[model samples]
Target: MPRWFNTAGPCRADHHYMLPALRRLPEVLPLIGQESYFVLHAPRQVGKTTALRALAEELTASGRYAALHVSCEEGEAAGDDFAEAQRAILSRIRRSAEIYLPAELHPPPFPPSPDISLLGTALAAWARVCPRPLVLFFDEIDALRGQSLLNVLRQLRSGYSDRPTAFPASVVLCGLRDVRDYKVTTDSRGHLGTSSPFNIKVESLTLRNFTRDEVEELYQQHTHDTGQVFLPEAIDRAFYWTQGQPWLVNALARQMVEKLVPDRGQALTAAHVDAAKEILLRRQDTHLDSLAERLREPRVRRILEPLLAGLALGEVPADDLRFVQDLGLVRLAPAGGLEVANPLYREVIPRVLANTAFASLPPQSITWLRADGRLDTERLMEAFLAFWRQHGQPLLGTAPYHEIAPHLVLMAFLHRVANGGGTLEREYAIGTGRMDLCLRHGPDTLALELKVWRDGEKDPLEDGLVQLDGYLAGLGLDSGWLVIFDRRTGQPPIAERTRAVAATTSTGRRVTVVRA
Candidate 1:
């Protein structure tokens, strides 16, 4: 009876609050009209399927083409068995046609022949008999791999000439990547050989996430439907956290409207959005969990290690960077270089990197909390010193990205602080040679800066003091912590060398410098 935000599957206008699918992907219909095949790609859960299905329905409804959307995902299980994959794909086409098209427009049953050519042959048979020109969309095209994928592509390439009558007038291959990237893992025996399959594609289009204005418009739908409103600040905070990520945009709103504050009488506020973020991050729902899982990938670590440590990137491969970008983990900043795509990802990445150390951390003692729940920074420092002396070295060894072991360990300890009723936020840029952290508990705020000392580098203390001073200036504080980790060879043992001393910045701000 009421529409809601959808996070799990394709959005339906009747049941879900959604923008016009065609508006997000306006290039599709014109491409189809030109009888051109193309590729549409974006990361998982970004509304790829919903846009394709919506366009297909509109085209079929217009009586211009017998449009049908089908998925090649079912063929993934066939692996190198291209014939089996072909059968699975063809079966789906017939089923989709029967359910969505009139009998006169539905595809005919498959021919007796079954092999790598079966997909091409079956589509040709359907096209020849259907009264209207057919347009097809093959969703999850990248899910097919090895020889199976190669054959599917080759068959499509083979069918390119017989169009508008002998075959579907237009074809779209939709997935998480450009088909050209598929060559990386494809079986060499049946190599795709330089765009032979999808080379007919005139263009490649990507569906973008909603803009801030789009997000506002989407939330306004709730106001129209139920007489409830999302306050302006709530809308702003939600966009800032999600960065217009489709699943996150819908998921965060769903969390507030469905679970956090179900009452339509109460106006949603920024606090509700913040609470929803904490729940989403803590629960590590399927979407976030899948994102965290990407951290284990070696390519991911290669990019993130230097990012966390605020050091320059090395000779990383372009394809690897593109692949990570395609996965929506990082984006090229307007100023250049790369950054984690959104603030939420920026937080999740480091926490996930440090999860191992957090697990092995000793149970937290309440000594770090003041009577009124404010953080006792001095007490927390004492606890950290004792903990670092005993466990920091071993915990450093457990860091998933070794280059930023110290950063991860410190984050792990701070995470323990956050769990005890507070929040810890991180900020760093490649080549900054330092990471800044902000910890808040009730009314108390603590700022921390981390630096690594190595064999050839100058003493980072002066630079760290300056950086920490600037950080303090931003938070309007007079004092904060600057931690320097000695990672050079032949250094004194960590337990023996660890200590904290007071220092001053060039600007006369006070700093507590810890050397380990």
Candidate 2:
């Protein structure tokens, strides 16, 4: 059977086009060799489970250790009940050991005890009787919560010194976060911030996304198997869109090969990859949906809100930034700042946030289209001005994020225009101090820059025009729009303030300045 790209679960060599899992996790072997307990963390679906499971099998096959990959996820349902959680975890470990380890290495049954804290004792007994030094990979360790989580970490820490002979040597705790970010509490009081119960963790290593070369190598597997080749430009486009995110890289390839263009005779081009990206964003597949659901989280909002609005992220807690990074919603930008992890996410974030507003919009006529079906720039601007006068304020409130309310409202209106087969692309980031929009309607391309005019600040028209000029230059256009949203106190109503005027940028580009 030919291997295919995998999106849903752990990648199996027999079924999926995959890279060497162990190569992605270089820190594991050295840590195991030194008999150290460590944490392996990364965003969901980035192959943490696959990597650890492969390591376990390889270690056991070497005949030097009894290694098993066990999950603590079942214990999540137990909540704060330490006894129930402990039982669920131990049962999972026993079942996993029976399947993955040799008969002689299978852990003996746990000693019957009422004390939930005896998990360490049970492990000690198993190690003492096992034929070899034991190595264990505990997956989903962060799924335990409240007292259950605290108890498990403390129990593991209690057995730290008894490794190799009395307890598992070189244990690994695997989850979406490092040990420092685990939420643990000793009593009914709120979270014990940053205080890890499992302080014995030697290091917290994160699994990184694939590099450009890795992305190409994985795609090449499909070509080698079935004779369907992805063109060089398509490969470059895929890397640019996904930033080597594993699931996204695979999903885009799957959508293009298996669904979009299944004919093996046709070469996949850059255009095919771009179309696949749009389909994935519109469909909001399980992975993207999971990411969208996290938008409601406070920490997620703290970073993403200002990011979308193109406002300065001032005074944000360091942990919040780190948390967002761990979730894979943002990354350290190559330009020395944080940005949405990839172009695909940059598009998804606003669309997901504007979904409600998109639905609430009244039906609009395509008055901006010329007789030849081309978009008329002036007519489009006039229509937007009229729409802003009528329903902009109300629609702004419909957005889930407040900082980007105006931006969302405008995007919702543009989405209505693009509904007729045009495309709207957005660009915003920290320190940008503005949001740039590019609308492509048939042969027409319009560039727009949006800036807010607050009470204490001067009018942003000069800066907006300058920025829009640069944006237009990049797109090889000679004209665009600079929209200044007057958000200052004591301003006239939106209807009264909304208007457009002709202006010229310092770079000699003609610009239509809209104030609303």
Candidate 3:
């Protein structure tokens, strides 16, 4: 295969991609007959459409099922016009079938208009005429809006019973969100939020990112085809940076192969992957741009602020959760908790928000302590308290990322200190209450947890002490400092709130205080 550098799916010249989802077809194929309506949702560009398309093609080739891939995105603009939307769907089905299927598998007639009743009629006609079972893979099902969405689902539900010989045996709805997250309504008078056309879904299936082993295998495929081996650290960097997001994984590799090392003669190392990450982030490519774009939404801000402070969101509405998850900003873990969906996302968010922070820091001025090395908690806190005494009020109120502003600024300071020599790893997502930042400077590690307290709380002193103790205890460290930002406090003089290092907690552990 030749080298591929353009945007889009696997190109003909370079088709070395071996997606694990495709390899698991044997497992997924049998489930289709048993499950009437299945859903496959994930963050954008994770190969949800590609995987289903491949499945549909394989099923059609088996001579047992006549599979068709139809996109609902084009018709979604119809809003509440169910009939027009249905016609659009049918037209897409006709076109897709013609393109993918052999010329002998003649296309069906797509009527000019299809109401709920006519949709069933048209589907039944196809099922009755076709020799094999009908399977419809509805791509971008979530794109359908208002009643157009409701009409399609209800039509599918109505025709579901007429299976095997009369209608599609199985239907797969693939999009950025699960079927359960779909909000459909038909109020031509106005718009609808949650009140109109509530939840109506059977179950949902989420497409997962490539696992660590799968990531390694995917990288090896590139090496096998191109002979540009990825060093162990490079593999680790790729997995850590992308968390195996399909497009990111491929794109990162492509950047390293074509842009970073066009000759393809040099071995790609972890540093190379790191360099590629810097380039991608600096350029702010479409993938990263789209992810960052949603941050402006109030819903996104509401959920993300608490998260950046290292707090857990108590209870969130299903819609908001689905919205964030769909954006690929976060994901629900197998352990039933929420986390940033992948590392690429985790790294990109802060970078986009604070571009000058890391770049301006002088790498040579900072020093990292080893594992046995100790940090002057009291001194650091004292310095910050002094700094806060002067600039705290003005900066806090003026911060762009208002909710998590303090945390972001604090991180900026530490990032400046640890610039060239240390690592800053963070875990904060929309809906996750607090942000947990782990800063490793050579051997010594500082775990700083941030929280935004509500009004009437002059001192979250009690709560802050308790949480910091727990965080320190988790790391089996008897010492660490906790910085609390009283968002409720009016901008007061920094001198009035200067730094104090007091041994506060039941353990008599020293906790440095920087009141900003």
TM-score of each: 0.96, 0.96, 0.75
Ranking by TM-score: 2, 1, 3
lDDT of each: 0.86, 0.88, 0.67
lDDT of 1 by residue, 1-516 (tens): 899999888999999999888888877888898999888888888899999899899999998899999999899988889899898998888888889888889777778675658988888998899888889999999889888888888888788899989988999999887777664354432324355566888887888888999999999999899988999999999999989998988989999999999999999999999888887877878888888887877767778788878888889877677767888888888899788888888888888888888888877676898787778888988998888988888888888887889889999999888887878888988889999999987788999999999989999998999889999999999989999999999987789999999999888888889997
Model 1 off-target regions past 4 Å?
A: 183-196
Instruction: Show pairs that collide, candidate 2.
Output: none
Judging by lDDT, tell me the better candidate of 2 and 3: 2
Best by lDDT: 2
RMSD (Å) of each candidate, 1 decimal: 2.1, 2.0, 6.1
Off by over 4 Å in 3: 3-7, 10-16, 24-27, 111-118, 185-203, 296-302, 322-327, 332-337, 352-402, 409-484, 490-514
Clash count for candidate 3 is 13
Residue-pair clashes per prediction, in order, are: 0, 0, 13
Lowest summed-lDDT stretch of 10 residues in model 3? 187-196
